[model samples]
Target: MTALPIHPDQRTPSDTSVPVSESFVSIQGEGKLTGVPSWFLRLAGCNLRCRWCDTPYASWEPESVSRPVDELCEEMRATGLRHAVLTGGEPMIFPQLLPLTERLHRMGVHITIETAGTVTRPGVRCHLMSLSPKLANSTPVGDPRDPSGKWAERHEHRRLNFASLNELIAGSPDRQIKFVVTGPDDLPEIESVLARVDGWKPDDIILMPEGVTVPDPDEVAWVVEACRTRGWRYGDRLHIRLFGDTKGT
Candidate 1:
């Protein structure tokens, strides 16, 4: 598979065009608002490439239909669901999101923007900002597709942006800081991240296991114990458990 070029800078409203991978209605699978009925709009494109990325189709190649702001709003309105989630390879990279979210809010829809927390848009509005910052574990190794370790270096440099994370946390009315835990080794990294952010309660943090389908039982147990000990929350990939790794959930 061929990976597409990365667009790290924020786009403009006049150039408010978005590449949409897919959109569907599904229960909130992870983070603070789990089990809530919601509509997901998965936008295409991302800057960093994680080793265990689940949505490679949406990120690696990023082949998607160019949808205008009005068309996207129409789809969201047609869903007739009050809860809507704007997810992506990274949604904030597109300036079109600002207007799209504004429309959703006007329709009285509660919006959740899921992101890697490496980018932020001040004008974008979201009821909940689900921030999942990538860690060292995300660095891709020697894969035949990217043997030059380019993705590894890029992922490392661009994975964590404390400025963006802080802004998203402060801007959103409700927020959750989710960290993908691959194993016990990643615990310290999580703590390091927590130390950087101020004014966050234990309940605001969520630890999720890194897996495509259902999380491993052993990993879940360890994460549960860690969450219990730290007074944080444990997140399960509910969509993976319920609908497997298939798209359009």
Candidate 2:
């Protein structure tokens, strides 16, 4: 039930230019479109810092080259792939995505935006809105990599945006909400989120195990059983299972 801070300047025209972390063709790892061949465009920058986040390079110490919409479209065209995934850091934070998704649509690519559902941009086009709302388990803490602990408070403050989650679900033709579960203890928080989102069905919910290269077998089994009991779907990190945590799949 956390509310996002008001930032009127959050959606400005300058956001049309994005910091490109990395782009590559890979198999869809999680959610409904698992196993689908997709061209991934990983953008930099995010509002929340999940403690179990797999891609720290894109969040904690983000480094990337700024690329224009047209340039990114051309890169996807070169891949000759039909499916395109706009992932992050947090893709919705950038307003440039409106143009990026529009251009990709014209190229006849099916777009899937992988997001934490903390921000919403109505103008952006998306085929599948893959919403992975952060649970309490994602609360950040001090680490050697980030000694200041600045991200801890910031992450807790912005992790959940019920308004954005509803808007994204209402607008998209298809949507899948995934939750990275640390253990059985996270179930109540997931239920609370589900209770807030009207019209969410069991089929629309997916549970994934937390980990980078490989999900712990015990955790996966526990989640699988939980999914069975709740009638929700279990999602596997296919890319990780196949290629470990290697970059670019």
* Ten contiguous residues minimizing lDDT sum, candidate 1: 1-10
Highest lDDT: which candidate?
2
| Residue pairs in candidate 1 whose N, alpha carbon or C atoms collide under 3 angstroms | none
Candidate 1 per-residue lDDT, tens place, 8-116, comes to 3323454366899998889998887889999899999999888888888777778688878777778878887889999988998877787787767778888899999
Q: What is the lDDT of residue 233 in candidate 2?
A: 96
lDDT measured at residue 30 in model 2 versus the true structure, 0 to 100: 85
Those runs of model 1 whose alpha carbons end farther than 4 Å from true positions after fitting are 1-15
What's the TM for model 2? 0.91
Q: Model 2, residue 59: what's the lDDT? A: 91
Deviation of model 2 at 85, angstroms: 0.1
TM-score of each: 0.91, 0.91
Off by over 4 Å in 2: 1-16
lDDT values of the candidates?
0.83, 0.84
